[model samples]
Target: MNPVRATTSTTGALVRTGAIATVAASAATMAVAAVGHAAGISLDMSGAPIPVTGFGVLTAAFSLIGVVIAALLARFAERPRRTFVRTTVVLTVLSLVPDVIADAGAATRALLMLTHLVAAAIVIPAVARRLAA
Candidate 1:
């Protein structure tokens, strides 16, 4: 296989995988939020309760950002899979900072963090798999 053609193929696969992962992560996060809400965990922040759809919206947005990051790493990194996993894991952990300190109650904060983890768990590995080792 020509190197350029191989690279293009890999990039195309990465995009496809990332897009599917984003949708899955978004839906998974939304389901998590809905379950939490049903179980009486408040999705409230500040003074307002977060709608269930907000989870899907935010997850899709951020997961798409993660996809972009993976694409960039695939293009530039010598070990794109390792770098993407490391970078996204750190980012996923860092993403919980706001949830920990939000004005919401403990349960709500925990629920928020859980949703973040769920989305990251769904997206990071999927995108990483498509990256060069």
Candidate 2:
């Protein structure tokens, strides 16, 4: 196979893996958040009601963003696994900034951060591994 064809095939496989991982991570995050909500851990985002649907939507969206980043890195980065993992770690840290600054109570902020970490935990490694493969 030509170099371009090989690269495209690899990138495609990476993207498919990323998509599956994204969905699983999102579902897991939603389940945890639901349990927290039932236990009186409010997920109020600065007084705005964050319904379950909203949670799923946001999770899926952000997870897809990670997938896209992974795909790009797989296609172009000199060292795809290292570059993608490092970029995602930096982005994950930046993502917590809003939660820290939000006017919501401490528990809510903490829960939000946890969700972010959970999603990152599932996505970052899966994508990086695929990229490396």
lDDT of each: 0.92, 0.85
What's the TM-score of each model vs. the native? 0.95, 0.93
Candidate 2 lDDT tens digits, 14-48: 88988898888888888878988998998787688
Q: Which candidate ranks first by lDDT, i.e. highest?
A: 1
Question: Across residues 1-133, which tens digit of lDDT does each residue of candidate 1 receive?
Answer: 7999988888889989989998998899989999999999988899898999999999999998988898899999999999999999999999999999999999999999999999999999999989889
Off by over 4 Å in 2: none
Candidate 1 TM-score, C-alpha based: 0.95
